[model samples]
Target: MSSKAKLKAPVAAKKPVELIKHADVRVDPYFWLKERDSEEVLKYLQEENAYNEQMTEHTKVLQENLFQEMKGRIKEDDSSVPYKKNGYWYITRYEVGKNYPIYSRKKETLVTAEEIMFDCNVEAKGFEYFKMAGISVSPDNKLVAYGIDTVSRRNYTIRIKNLETGEIYPETIENTTGGCTWASDSKTLFYTRKDEETLRSDTVFRHQLGTPSTTDVEIYKEEDDTFNVFVYKTKSEKYIVIGSMSTLTSEYRILEADNPKGDFRVFQERIRGVEYGIAHYDTRFFILTNIDGATNFKLMETPEAHTESSYWKDLIPHREDTLIEDVDIFKEYLVISERNNGLNKINIKRWDGTEDYYLPFDNETYTAYVSTNPEFDTTILRYSYNSLITPNSVIDFDMKTKQKEVKKEQEVLDPNFSKDNYHSERVWATAKDGTKIPISLVYRKDLQRDGTNPLLQYGYGSYGSTIDPYFSSVRLSLLDRGFIYAIAHIRGSEYLGREWYEQGKLLQKMNTFTDFIDCSKYLIAEKYTSNQHLYAMGGSAGGLLMGAVMNMAPELYNGVVAAVPFVDVVTTMLDESIPLTTGEYDEWGNPNESEYYFYMKQYSPYDQVKPQQYPNILITTGYHDSQVQYWEPAKWVAKLRELKTDTNLLLFHTNMDAGHGGASGRFDALKEVAEEYAFLLDLEGIKG
Candidate 1:
């Protein structure tokens, strides 16, 4: 053939390397510690000691650089926006950006700031404690209930604050407390507390406001030893709903709030193959469920009796390829957030069952929280939107008038910032079994589309999680430096609906790993990036994804950072003594059983590490981590050192204080991110 003709001919794609069978995979005793004699391995853990010194220097530099860069950018606004509630306005702002401060907005005039409430930082002694995940406000807006962490990473204490008078009532509880609710009369506050030893056990407590008693009345206690319980009170303040969870799923029950302390009746029986979320509407309970194994859900309402036999009505029927995210009941309508065609839209449906209206925003905008005041017939929708080059914009939308207002627009660094500088596209790749997986790519537009760019891919495909489009200031730093950032929407995540999540979890869990590999390959084949310059990162369960991908296709990535990873799956799954393991048996099959154990052993990162080529890795953990303990990553690194063929660096850094999350403050968090990015930059040979 002529030289010109030969050059014009297309080249065939490379085939994926077949996975080694579990029985055939070999282990190397000195895989990671080849440099050390067995005697040296026991002699002060030299590798670990070196890693600690390196990490200390790395963290110190990262903290200094991040603080210098972000000090001027930290918004310190003393002005408090007036929020009118129950005939009065409350001004809320942060004091010194360290504690939640008090500012009152009255009659459009700013009142003198007073210390009406104390934040967790003030209540807890130390730099480690973080505030509770959620907060509640009383109907009359007089009492505010919030939770605080006391036992480092294990326990939470619910505290009540009287807004009228700057006083904190009932300082703490010994157990883990959450889900705070206030009665309509505002005389009593309700919250849920649980024992740290029993993962699934919890009890609901009611404490009368203004009382100095150190004890609380127990309204309800979950009796089942095998089931976990969660409780929430309706916004109407009429009923309390309790959700009971077994290894597989959960069941919801409802109780009357008139007595405020009574037995709850089973509102919905434990339906097999369904997940439910409960909301209240018009003095009735509306439960959203994915019954019959359909990934999309339908709304079922109990308008009268709090039992399965009660008159059941369907508010919204399930539709294929569409999933409802959240539903808010307004005065005469219901606003539902639904995801379809890879975009999220808000649909307002009349209570009379007619579709009133639909509002759609750019898919890149992430609507994190929605709030509505039915009394004023107004709604406040909070959202943040950004892209590869854009920083972020936090906007507020008025639902009734369909008008949008900018609340807090994230300041872009410079006029040089432009989305045209970078491009983002969504593509799909087929996994090992022909399952189509979605992947999002963001890269510099000027870079050659010849698979030569340095790429950093991320994924978290578990727990029905959806990694939607959201802006990251730190990520912009990578994009500006010509690094491609991609997200693999693998199975075990609800990104593509329920079936996508189900297909990726449990015995079918290997799909998450294979899907990530396929995405990496697709990026190279499609000329988006090259395998030589590729890096991967994930944390928590996502960290497990990172470990799996590294083991299955080590050649695909040059660097991997697994933070607080669930690496020792087999050991963790079988050990009931660890926190959250027993409760997570449903998500990951119980390893106590032979079948489950065998399935988990097949892909457990720490168990599967063999003497083969591997990539540079940085594994991080927290000493006080309750979810995934420090021993997991520590032991995984130890085992990897014994087995890996490649001499690539493997570093482990354990946070002395903190839980599953490694950082405690904003600066601390930024420093952690900067350090991780520094490692990636160092591997990619990109000088910061």
Candidate 2:
């Protein structure tokens, strides 16, 4: 603990900048941090990094121990379950010492010699930050296309490797979406490209083999700044799709894969507020849409040739209680992923209307979803299933016989770990508005309800994204060490239904902050943990949750970890050049309008910082984060340091080489988690 006094936290020099929106004026003192490469900004960040090192120096050994403990539980030399696609069985395996996966495939049978398609470990050798994505093989199986991002900005370089010749093509397409969809001809490939500055995916280009990327044809372009464009092939592999989507609407274009050069016709034209996604079956397309007042979404079908909003006929009519998250179509069965009562369920129906049943889940808070089922005629359905106390498992179910078999369950290498040693359950906490929020709890089986134990509560309630209760090996580290971990299934997510999301967005955004605070209060009242022992952690938008909660109820927790937080809400939304500003206008109202401007300033963390007490805080950011610029967190910590009354520990750390995700390597990212764990445990007087 003496190390905490060795260095003072960095104080950013202020240069007030005035921001005016809709005739409303506000001044930001730490706005100079927005200069990505300014010397002053770099110096400030470096000083903060040095300060963090000095403050955490006492826990360095403890951090390493936690890292090694978690690392020990991972089966480093592991391989994914092989799935049959086209004519090959694809398996992504990791060598004992490598940080990346090795993609390989075998023809016809597992006994055959494997072909090494792409060795990501070798490709990622010298780069400080490296990520490989979108491994797609040609339909003919002679070529492999993949995207690699070396700078950690998410803009990938599309490369082609000839499996037969073991040579990478001389031509490389840069600044793509890290995905490539191949045509049926195998010679042509399509990928989405991003703008140079805004980094929005706006164009889809078609590249033919043996030709320079400079000659690639622009197949489509989305002129709308709010919408992003991406290209993919349908599950049927019959057609390539170009989708343009914004916050509240979407439109799609389709071209037959066999006709690579054919014009892509609009499957559905954009409507003001309608959003829909399509799945291809025999001769029709199933449309999942939020059309006609379907708050929980609905499904409709239309003839493939008559693909239009006006031609869609009702298939599964809108249900107010059920949200259709995804769909998988097969020759004789339709598998639907639905969420009802905040639980995930899969509905399987025979095409002949003979049988319709839901796949059962015994755990109240487990996450289950359809896995890779590439074949259109297969009767076997593969799905992923897991809960807070269960290891991740891949289950294969036979639709005809309703037989289930476990293909694999993640292995925790530690012999002391057991599912019987832990306990998990679902509970409801009433918010201030009488809304019952679901919270998933997991802890050691011997946990005592004496309110003396340490608890870490996590939440993310934005973007209509549900924070499901899933198993994590790293979580075991805390659970084993007398920590109760809970996930607050708050609003701003489609957990209960679409209405849950609607109630926490735009004008109602404060509900999200209030809900998290209410959950914490409930836990404290129920004797789970007290204000002196509770810890909070969340990332990105959830980090915004942490900032807002700390402002609203500072004494509720002992420490808070905000990673890559988006806290400078007002200024960020005012600038459309930021990565997601324009697209998120509907989610977070446009601040250019006076009504939204004043509403945003109320809860915007940077603007709301006051001369008050705050719990121990650790904020981490990445220099190249594309989603929320690093300056958001940089300015947030600065303002908090300047205004907060209490002399509580406040630290900031920035990853100099990485982006939003923190670290590129699997093991390297665990180090960041270990550091946060050490921070929390150190505050609780549990130093290794």
Candidate 3:
């Protein structure tokens, strides 16, 4: 027998279950796959993995070649630009062949003796999955607290290191959100913890460095299931903030950063429909809020001492078209990150009352956002900018002199590479509803607008998450080939402003799916690509886009890739025990309500699966993923195999060790991308 025939795809056991919702009856035979970690489930997953390996064995060489090609373009022995924070220039670097970064710092100049604070390579020695997040140095610079997750779940354990003694404290805080705010005293730390079942960050705890985790005091607890909690120190270093936020509402409590035993007071009372963000500046609290029908969001200022909604005075009034994405405050100036006409723009306003203006971006489609402006008194504003054709760049703009310096642009080590060899532009793709969707695209400069090119169109149109056109060195492999890469700025994202996001979510959720299909159709109509050689890719919530588009317009593409997709929407949303289900009701709507139940089922990929032809598909998931459970994709694949009539290659690959994020190591994650690229290239008949 042939190797492919010898390794048959796993046939999941049929355990028919009826889901009657909104007066509709649906039978799911693979629902039993949700019994995660069971022996039978594990065996079935293993069989799927084996089958995937067998089916893609022909592309193993291509995968390895792609991996090496990507690796070759990276400057491995490289370090990030030093940014001064609390009397230290924090620098993170990677060695010749290390899979993790070495976090080090110099006291003064680059010539000073380097103090290796955290060698992630050494820390990740034995773990199959490891993530280091939320690294913060104490105010005194003598202690550093960091969060680590070895299980691939987002829950992290807080660990502290003494810079002077080079010793790790025995006390550890568990089930945290991978970050902690340190009191000015340095001994006290406050962190948020996840719920035991839902894994939502719902409680904040105060811990003294040497105390046992058991003795930690619960500082605050959010009672609302729709809300998640987080703790952070104000930019002015005056107060530590405990924030509770849901999809549509927000609340905040503030306590003096130096006073761990101090009482916390509400910054603003929570209103059912209002959403606001706070930043401390001088004696005023600057609020970015969506109050008073500011659909696109606006900036307001209120007294720091009396932070009530009534006390709020308009600073930057609501504009129907402009979206204030973020704000960065410094002693002499405030930098605003805004999106106008589907493009990012940075505005600088000096406290000295100088003329305010925006930093120039030459590219038609690019990403520009504030980066690492740590010092309160500094005149330099550090921001990051990148585009489809430009390398990621960090710029130090003198907010005073109006002069800018490119501090660093990513060193793509490939000798034959040049930005001039590629071209990037923006085009509007008209949606079915007459909405003009922005599409960012890049390809070889010499490429012709022919229908023969293999194209990958990507999107994530949910949760107001805008997918900016950012540079990727790994993407050069596709560009170097006869391929065009495009990002469809679809609805459900705040790309065009809040209204863009509003129109794509809730009852309008189908717009996100159709918007993507329309962009694909536009590309094909414009001769950039044809459906015969087109591909679709999205991950996490974006993975949902991939699933929906596959069902709605299966004939539009040749293959589709869904990464850790939230496919079983109706069932997952019905179960409030899932990590993100409750909080996402505002985004996807509460399925318990009949209004949303039917709407969600209409697009829920697993629920909508029919015995029809689907493009060749590759679904990836991490077994330990808390955000989108592994069984989602597992059950999805099983259902597809049982029902689909097409003979196209269908695959389900699960990383047994990882979670929401596929891999934690720097180089290890590239392997996943390499596999994805290999799959895309193989489908296009571009064999290595």
Task: Score each candidate by Cα lDDT.
Answer: 0.68, 0.92, 0.92
True-vs-predicted CA distance for residue 207, candidate 3, Å: 1.0
- Candidate 1 C-alpha lDDT tens digits along 262-329: 66677777755556777776667677777655468877787645546346667778888888877877
Model 1 bad stretches (over 4 Å): 1-50, 55-63, 70-92, 95-116, 119-125, 198-201, 209-214, 223-226, 246-248, 256-258, 306-310, 352-355, 362-376, 379-392, 413-415
Question: What CA root-mean-square deviation does each model show from the true structure?
Answer: 8.4, 1.0, 1.3
Show the colliding residue pairs in model 3: none
Question: Which 10-residue span in candidate 3 carries the lowest summed lDDT?
Answer: 1-10
Per-residue lDDT, model 1, residue 646, is 72
For model 2, residues 1-688, the per-residue Cα lDDT tens digits are 4556655778899899988767777889999999989999999999999999888888999999999999999999999989999989999999886788888999989999999888888888889999999988999999989999988789899999999999998999999988999999999999999998889999999999999999999999899888999999999999999999998899999999999999999998999889999999889999999988887889999999999888999889899789999999988999999999999999999989999999988888799999999988889999999999899999889999999999999999999999999999999999999999999999998999888889999998998999999999998989998999999998999899899999989999999999999999999999999999999999999999999999999999999999999999989998888888888898999988888889999999999999999999999999999988989999999999999999889999999999999899889999999999999999999876
* Tens digits of per-residue lDDT for model 3, 272-347: 8899999998899999999999877888998888999999998888888899998999988888899998889998
- Candidate rank order under TM-score: 2, 3, 1
Best by lDDT: 2
Stretches of candidate 2 off by over 4 Å are none
Show the colliding residue pairs in model 2. Answer: none
Model 2 vs truth, CA RMSD: 1.0
